[model samples]
Target: MIGKLGQTSRRYRDDARSATSRRLVIGATGVLTALLTVIQIAAMPAGPTPVRHPLAQGSVWDSVYTAAQAARGEATFRKTCAACHGDSLKGIDDAPPLTGTEFHKSWDGNSLSAIFTKINNDMPSDNPGTLSKPQVAEVVAFILQYNAYPAGKADLAASADSLGGIKFLPKP
Candidate 1:
C-alpha cells in the first residue's frame, strides 16, 4: 500500500510539472508576440506630408483667361454643353447649375486646376472626356466670363500645372 501511495504521488508531481511548464510556455509566447508587434511598428518608415497646389492657395481675382478665349468658349459651350446645362448654363433635371450663387459657392476657395481636371475627365454626359485640351480651356474661359470674372489679355492654358496655378476665389 505504501509503494502504491509513493507511485501515485510521483505521478501527481509529474503532471503538475507538465502543466506549469505549459503555462510558462504560453505566457512566454504571448509576451514574445507583443514584443514582435511593437518592434515591427517602430521599424516602419515615416511618410512625407502632402503638399497643396500653388493655385489652391492663390485667388481667381488674379489675371486669367482672355475675352477672346471666353467668346470662343461660349460658342463651344452652346454646341456641346447647352443640352444638359441649358441654353443659359442654368442646368436641367438631375444636372446641377453651372453658374450663379450655387456654382460660385461650390467652387469658392478651391483650385481652378481641380475643376479643370474634373471637366477634362468627366463632362458632356453622352460623350464624357471627348473634349480636346484647347476646347476644355475655352469652355473654362466661358464659365469664367459667365461668372463675370475680369478677362485678361492672355488665354488660359489647358495644362494641369497652369490651371492649378489659378485659384478659384469667392465673388466680390
Candidate 2:
C-alpha cells in the first residue's frame, strides 16, 4: 500500500510538469505570433499621398481661369463646337446648351474635371477625342466666361487632377 501511494504521487508530479511545459510552449507561441504580426505591419510601405494645389483651393467662384484663356477657348469653340451648340452657346437640335438654367442644372455642384473630361472625350461630334489637353482646358475656360464666371490672372491648367479640385458652383 505504501509503495502504491508513492508511485501515484510520482505519476501526479510528472503529469503536472508536463502540463506546465505545454502551457509555457503555448504562451511562447502566442507571443511570437503577435510579435511577427507587428513586424510585418511595420515593414509594409505607406500609400501614396494626394497632391494639392494652391490655385484649386476653392470652387469656380474663386476665378479659376484667365480671360485670355477664355478667348482662346472661344476661338476653338467657334471652329469646333459652334455648329452643334450654336454661336451663342444655345443648344441647337440634339446638342445641349452650355449656359443659363440648363447648364447650371446639369453642371452645378460637379467638378470641373467632369466637364473637361466630357469635352475632351466627346466634343466636336464629327471628330471625338481630337482636341488636345490645352485646347480642352481653353474650351472649358470659354464656357465659364460665357456663364459669367470671373477671370483670374492664371490660365486654367490642362490637368485633370487640378480641375477635379475645382467645383462648378451656381453663379456667385
Candidate 3:
C-alpha cells in the first residue's frame, strides 16, 4: 500500500511539472510575439508629413491666376494635352476630365500646388515630365479659367511653394 501511494504521488508531481512547463512556454511565446510586433512597428516608415506654407493660407477663389496666364496655358494645352484631354478638356480614353464637376470632385479642398506637382510630374501621358515649371503653372491657370474661376492681375507663379499655399475650392 505504501509503495502504491508513492507511485501515485510521483505521477501527480510529473503531471504538475508538465503543466507548469506548458504555461511557461505559452507565456514566453506571447511575450516574444509582443516584442516582435513592437520592433516591427518601430521599424516601419512614417507616412508623408503635411507641409504648411504661409502663402497657402488663401483659397483659389482669391484670384491666384491671371487671364493672360490662362491664355498661355490654353495654348500650351492645345499643343500638349488636347490629344488625351480633348479640345473641351473632357477626358478621352483612359484620361480623366479636367474641368467642371469632375474636376471639383477630384480637386476640391486640395491645394493648387498638389495639382501643379501632378502636372509637372505626370502630364502629357506619353511625354511625362516634359513641361517646364512655368508651363505647368500656365496649364494650371488655364484649367482654373476653364472652370470659370475669376482672374487676377498677377499671373500664377511657377514656384511650387507659393502655389502650395492656394487651396482649390469648388466655385462659390
Candidate 4:
C-alpha cells in the first residue's frame, strides 16, 4: 500500500508538470500571434496618404506658370543667362540651348523639381547657387514661356514639393 501511494504521488506530480508546460506553450503562442498582428497593422499605409504626381499626358500646352512670373523670369534670364545662352537662348559654344530639342527631350516626362533643383544649385557657370529660390523659380517660368508653354493664373512656387507635383511632357 505504501509503495502504491508513492507511485500515485509521483504520477500526479508528472501530470501537473506536463499541464504547466502545455499552458506555457499556449500562452507563448498567443503572445507571439498578438505581436505579429500589431506589426502588420503598423506596417500598413495610413491616412492623409502621400500624393504622387503623374506624368503629363500632352505637353506644356496646359497652362502651368503665370504670365507675370514669366515676365519677371525674362528679366532675370537677360541679366544672368543671356550672356551664355544668348538672346534667343540658342546656346553659346558649350552652353546648351534652354528652349529646344535638347532641353525638352531631357526634361520631358520628368518632374519640374529636377529643373528647379539643377538651376537652384548649379547655374550661371561662374556663380553657383547664388540665385535665390524665387529667382530660380522665375527663371524656370521664363524657360517654360520660351518653350511655348502657356501661362496659368498663379505663379510657380519656389518649393520642391510644389514643383515635384508638376511633370514635364513632350510637345504635341
After aligning candidate 4 to the native by TM-score, how far in Å is the CA of 72 from where it should be?
Answer: 0.7
Minimal lDDT window, size 10, model 2: 49-58
lDDT of 1 at 141: 88
User: Each prediction's Cα lDDT score?
Assistant: 0.83, 0.89, 0.88, 0.84
- Give the range where candidate 3 is weakest over 10 consecutive residues by summed lDDT: 49-58
The residue-level lDDT of candidate 4 at 123 comes to 93
Tens-digit lDDT track for model 3 on 130-149? 99999999999999989887
Residue 72 Cα positional deviation in candidate 2, in Å, after optimal superposition: 0.6
Clashes of each: 0, 0, 1, 0
Give one digit per residue, the lDDT tens place, for model 1 in 1-172: 9999999999999999999999999999999999999999999766586443354335666558898999998998999989888988888997778898888788887778887887888888788989998888989989988888778778889877787757777743
Cα lDDT of model 2 overall? 0.89
| lDDT (Cα, tens digit) per residue for candidate 4, span 1-172 | 9999999999999999999999999999999999999999999886688433343333355577899999999999999989999999999999899978887778888788888998888898889888999999999999999988878787888976777767787644
- Residue runs of model 1 more than 4 Å from their true location after superposition: 1-57
Q: lDDT winner between 1 and 3, please give it.
A: 3
Candidate order by TM-score, decreasing, is: 2, 3, 1, 4
Best by TM-score: 2
Model 4 deviation from the true structure expressed as Cα RMSD, one decimal place = 10.7
- For model 4, the stretches where C-alpha displacement exceeds 4 angstroms are 1-59
